[model samples]
Target chain A: MHSEKELIDGCAKGDRAAQRAFYERYCGRMMALCNRYAKSTQEAEDILQEGFIKIFGSIASFRKEAKLTTWMTRIMINTALNMQRQKLYLLPMVDVNDANLYEQEEIGLSDFHFTELIRMVQSLPDGCRIIFNLFAIEGYGHKEIADMLNISEGTSKSQYNRAKSLLQAKLKAEQKYENVRGQKL
Target chain B: MKTSEDRNFEEEWKSALDGAEMAPSDHVWNSIDLKISHAEQGEMKKRVLFYQRVAAASILFALCLGAAGWFWNYEDASVKSLASQTVGENQKESASSIAKVPFSNQNSSNSSAVTITESQNANSIKSAVGNYENGVKTRIENGGKNHALASEASNGSDIAAMIAPADKNVLTLGKEAELESRRTSQSNTGFENGSVTELATNGLSMSAIRLTGKPVEQIESARTFKIAKKEQSPTDDQNRNWWASVNGSGGAYNQSSSSNSVATSLFQQSATSTFYAAPNSKEVGVGTSFSYGMSMGKKVANRWVVMGGVNYLNQSIDYQTNIVLQDASQSKAFLADLASLSSNLASTNPYVLRNTNEFISVPLQAGYLLLNRKAGVQLNAGVAADIFYRNTMTDLSGQFGSFSQAAGDNSVYRNLNWTGLLGTELSYKMNRHYQVSLMPGFRYSFNSVLKSSTGSTINPLVWDVGFRLKYVF
Candidate 1:
């Protein structure tokens, strides 16, 4: 079965060493999860500490019905969600009250690297960046984007288009600048 | 004109972002560390305050419990001073007029829950709490007494034979500890026959009484004192410090189930035989500590902390006005100000006073450190005083808030107050620098606010779950 199950069984025998081993195995991965959902790295770390506490404290409950990582991920998500609510963070909604405002414009790719597109997506302003991420990379509709960002579906569609157009222009400008620099060199 | 192929090439451009190349600033670790430290400190302060209350309860339990047939208190000053000296350690001592048959608190980690109080007119000095505690040494001693009581229940059966060499059944610590004790030393007042409830209410001058029919080989009651080592053997008094505190004491509320009465008695017996076994070997250290930890996770353990260096463990309850206003009017105004949203003016203001509130609190706790480490978590309880720290308010501005005041100075605050710590860290060694931690658990406070300044009041009872960390060096 799962490695955690064996470790847990060992711990049930009052094996302090096993318990310590268990803690070390998950601390890093949990910290990574904390980093994603936290407003600041510290806040995420705080969530990590709290999460591990619950983990070790409640280790007896871990019957190994699911993978250890899965169980830990759930705790991490819950902690992050709680922090988000407590800190009044800007979290994207999953569902939508509005419909998709913009249809995806198919810009066929021949030689474009996926990383360039991702960077372009990342470079957008907060509102636009989120909208593009939800629409382009995540494949969410405008309505879903609006719900998550707490904005109008129209705003989502407009922002997505604006992001795409801005990205296209930036790339073209960068390409021209590079060619000029190459000639001079 | 550009060809269709050229146009296609020009329009489509993409590059995959490598995870490592786009790494954020490395100093992010420091930033994360700062917040984590801040939150951890606040949480630690809260927990220690809670532990202090429980310690108080445990001390009180040691007094109220007559299960061991001990003369609860003696009417003498020197003895009372001894008990009162442990006041800083615990705040929940009561005066019972019961006899001091071999005193057994089911929760005593220390063999004898001996304490010397220094209260102004210390009654229980020689009576009950006397010869036992220091202000800071009071709580842990009592908690240890109670802990010993519980532990005795589990292991007493094993140690009973150790008490008397003739008997194979080493006197189980907590088992059958009913030594005949009486509170009828004075006239014919409180005691109906030989039975009395408390030793001396607040008057700790209760005397010791035991019917030693068990045939002791000696005349004077056997009392054992464990001597310190050649090195600076950190007395409980020397242990209390500002920077670090080790709080293993949880709570002293349940007197009947107190492990001290059993454990302390057994340990006392065992301690008497210390010449055979090393005191250092049986010694489990009590540490006092001060530390700051940042909660390093948002999902499970989100926190931030900052270090405050101070030696005083006094608890005061002060109110803070926290204002939580949901302003739909402001939102509408902003929307109106944005000329673009004028046409779609159907949206109304979402801001209306949702929750205008106030909180009441009494924060209680006592703190001290050993070798610069805060002490708590094992001995299992402590004592503290509490007051109010108000944080909720609805002022003249018609705004809702968790804390805010239009009249006088208003702000939301976490004033250290009184609380009862229930469970403690079951000893977990972390990094070399920080070894102190707790088994996650809950704390209950008689008062609401955990802390307070001068004249402020608020209700504050928070059920917090986080680790208490400390630096050993």
Candidate 2:
């Protein structure tokens, strides 16, 4: 039940108990954050392991200027981004013209499982999914995402728009299918 | 300044995933734990290595100083004993010459009256004295030039002239006959009287020998004695005080176990990574090392030398680590996909890593002569403070070409370390000024050359055989 400051001090000194306590305390949220950026459970686990390793390695540099959770979240996100970059370097980029044309229509937001929503986000293309997560969930602007991903601001915006349109289309289709199933019942 | 529709969509997504949680498999923590534990162990190893180096350096420095001091005191005592022996020998020669003159004068004056008896007596005295003089001359020749004894021998003629009058009664016929019989009997008994007399002279010289009572000529002769001694044994001459040597050595350098294990772990980790297609096969060959240095030594004693100087060594190692690519067809599709994203993925061949390092060291060495002859051997040991000069890595292209560079920055290696050396030199004396030697030795480092954080704690154990050419002054 030590405070965040005490845990950080202990972790810096490489106290095993303190490290385990710290990991258990923040791992759920961090894993969820990693999950948002990864396409599968295994990839998310990989990112999670890499992120915690970094946190423990650099805990001495954590001056507690920001909240511990905020600092850890930033580390997790960076780890996921690096993992994406490595994977992206090996894969071909999809043509921009292949993005599905869709209308910007309002979609039902209720009655969707949280896991289903995560699935929808994960289903987006690799480049579009990262931009979408950084912009929509991580609260980063298009300019920041562009700098982070080494792309133009316009590309970041276009990628975000494509991800949003695709998610909207999928959500709408799922909601209509659920309604049709209810009518048959 | 976000658009309304964009703001709504972001809010919807955020709320939808607000409490979403997925616990990773238990093995994720295990993997993290393993990495952290390895890093901690590495840190501990570094600290231990550093302390070991300090202790080793301190012990080596103290030992060199202690040996030099001990040998210096011993040499001083030997020189004093030898000087005392020379003074005693000089006194004996003086007495013997004085006794001989009277006998000679008596024999010449009374030749007709006691010709038969005196001739017999003369023969006896001359035989005994000649034997003693011949023995003394042989000792002087074999013991090298002794200026004190040579000067005293010359002064014997003067002593004989001074003591001639006081010895008249002792030189009478009856007493002379008795003295001859006694000298003859003693000579017959194997020079026992002569030996006793020599011992008495040694005691007297030790107590009463005074350079102050001597004339200026005698003092000048004593000075010349030292010059003659130096000329006789030029190798042992204290006046020739400087020596220089050039040596070159080659040996095999071995890495420590801890470092090798850590490197293996890292290689395994890389092999398991998704980027690499196959497991790495690492072969570490015997590393070839070469070193040469020029050092100047001072002869501190007859059998001791102390030297301090700089040395430079370049060590290179060739370790082939096969970065086997996956099946060509499977990798082709992957490479084509990778090519569109980054043009740097042009080649996919296994590469070899060649590591080279250079070092400069300042060594303070102490040597003791175990044997001194035409063929001799000596033992030497010292401590060296070594500074790392450079480390270079060359990736020779494999079947395809070189892949992305994976080596860490060379600047991360530790710049300074200390090593302990123990070696023996087998030497052949060519002349008074030049000698050649073969020095075989081993050097052990007490600290790692690379930083611990790099997880590479390479400490080299090197065995060297060197050829040396030396000049002594």
lDDT of 1 by residue, B119-160 (tens): 222222223443433221111111111111111212222222
Candidate 2: segments with Cα more than 4 A from true spot: A92-102, B55-59, B66-473
Top candidate, metric TM-score: 2
TM-score of chain B of each: 0.23, 0.44
Worst 10 residues of 1 chain B by lDDT: B139-148
Clashes of each: 259, 1
Span of 10 residues, lowest total lDDT, candidate 2 chain A: A92-101
Could you estimate the TM-score for every candidate?
0.28, 0.43
Q: For model 2, name the residue pairs that clash.
A: B147-B225
lDDT string for model 2 (B73-187, tens) is 4543333343334333344433332122212233323221100011111222223323331122111011111111211212223332222333211110110011111121234
lDDT agreement of model 1 with the native: 0.35
Error of 1 at A90 (Å): 11
What DockQ would candidate 1 receive versus the native complex? Answer: 0.06
